[model samples]
Target: MSLVSYTKALNRALGDALAADEAVCVFGEDVGAGLAGMTLGLQSRFGAQRVVDTPLSEQAFTSVGIGAALAGRRPVIELQIPSLLYLVFEQLANQAHKFSLMTGGQARVSLTVVVPGSGSRAGWAGQHSDQPYSLFAHVGIKTVVPATPSDAYGLLTSAIADDDPVVLFAPAAALGVREDVTAPLGPVPLGSARIRRPGRDVTVVAVGHLVHDALWAAQELAGEVDVEVLDPRTLYPFDFPALARSLRRTGRLVVLDDANRSCGFAAEVLASAVEAVPLLAPPRRVTRPDGTVLPFALDLDRALQPGRDQLLDAIRSVMA
Candidate 1:
């Protein structure tokens, strides 16, 4: 029974994966120095051979990981910033991601890319602060964003062990989040949605760090309007069954998402809900403005992000 932070849980997962399998290796910028903090002490324990630091080339290193995966090696790539995914989009989407189907299942890309400090961070500016998980999910890549430390450890372990390319987005806003733990945390299967807060009025589906905000908002709304918080941990292969069950219990739906409002993950979830589950009222989504690009100003950044008030209003709207 002990408390664990989200970052620590991620570090523990990487450590466990490296220790359990000889074929597992880590590659990324400044990984040897443990710059991202998720690989802290891993280089010393696993040595330079496995925890090797890569050059400042996201595309090259990602391609190398793809090649290694094809040759029967499991590689974990640590991208320090969420925006760096854009640099290797072709390598991931066209090459590694396509190998399995393009070759008719003879090859595999067993690589796990961990984006530490993802999503909007205070004053990280427009370039550094981007929550691009929706892009990967839209392109048919497996995407995971766990809200709790226990879930972080469990899902990361599962991602590293899976025989396909997976992207793990650890939101910067939730990095400091801690949880009191007692049981031995184990692998949480992908595509599973967790009901963080149960209610009868409206079902609220939240993503990444926004899940915490949804839970807090639900508590604040209390007797005025009961709100259920559903964390769709895996966005690509979303937990439709869980969403359907929640929708059945509560006739209203509200999605609280951190991404931009246009064609975003929130929109997709609401669209799916209305089509798959019968709702007494119209489903609503609270998200950033359309074509939103994070601003350099701190206050402007905060204004552009989704918060408790937005979730509360969306919940109330759905209920009304």
Candidate 2:
């Protein structure tokens, strides 16, 4: 087994995709230099044609990726910042995502949008710190937030190979995560959830970076309560079957996510569990308050985000 960082896993995935398929090309700003480290050494390895360093126009280049996909090229567009997603929302959510359905399955845009450093990067503040997976999920875009290095490698490969447009959000909080991987790196099927920790008392569903927090909280409260950790790797096209099975075993649910409260991914998970299965206790969700704009100050920023204490309280509340 070899230990690998999450950022390295991402870089490996991009390299593997480029090596495996000639049609797979990457386009984004500063890709020539691989400024984000996710695309490092890719331009030289894959050549300038395949690893394109696009102009500063995100909206225009985003649509260009869609066009390339339509022309039979699997284009992976790397967005250095997560908020840039808002700028090209129409290009992605409307054009790239709607192609297959709008054309009655005749047209497919096999495109992958990679947001390398999503979520808060300490003092990155309001504009650059948003974790917008919920936005893509709401529009039915295939969205993935991988917590571990292995998942980062596997899911990125799957997203590149998918026929539909997929958005892969690599949360900044999780970029530092490393794992000891024994298995040969490969693709993890989309729309699947993994049970990180098994328990019978309550299921703690964590999103993106919160998976680590959930696991820690579960361990901290191990003697007092049994907490199961469920990581829904793919936010959109969620693995409802796996979640249902966990819910059946646990009978209680608590969601810990970094997104805002109202209409967030956590809410969707809670709602779905309640609607489909019987709950032994009222489910709870720990997330940023509704309409949260992360403050610039250190304490204020930390205050607005969900943490271990909030997750622990939610678990206790559900147990009570």
Instruction: Indicate which candidate wins on lDDT.
Output: 2
User: What TM-score, over all chains together, does every model reach?
Assistant: 0.98, 0.99
Clashing pairs in 2: none
Candidate 2's TM-score: 0.99
lDDT, candidate 1, residue 157? 98
Q: Write the per-residue lDDT of candidate 1 for residues 1-320, one digit (tens) a residue.
A: 89999999999999999999988999999999887789999999999999989899998889889988999999999999999999988888888899999989999999999998998888889899988888899999999999999999999999999999999999999999999999998899998888998889889899999998888888888979888889999998999999999999998999988998888999999899888888999988889898888988999999989877877777887777
Candidate 2 residue lDDT tens string, 1-320: 99999999999999999999999999999988988888999999889999999899999788889999999999999999998999999888888889899999899999999999998888888998898899999999999999999999999999999999999999999999999999899999999999999999999999888999999999999999999999999999999999999999999999988998999999999999999999999999999999988878879899999989989999999999
Write down the lDDT that model 2 would get. Answer: 0.94
lDDT computed for candidate 1? 0.91
- Cα RMSD of all models vs. native, in order, equals 0.8, 0.8
Worst 10 residues of 2 by lDDT: 291-300
Backbone clashes for every candidate come to 0, 0
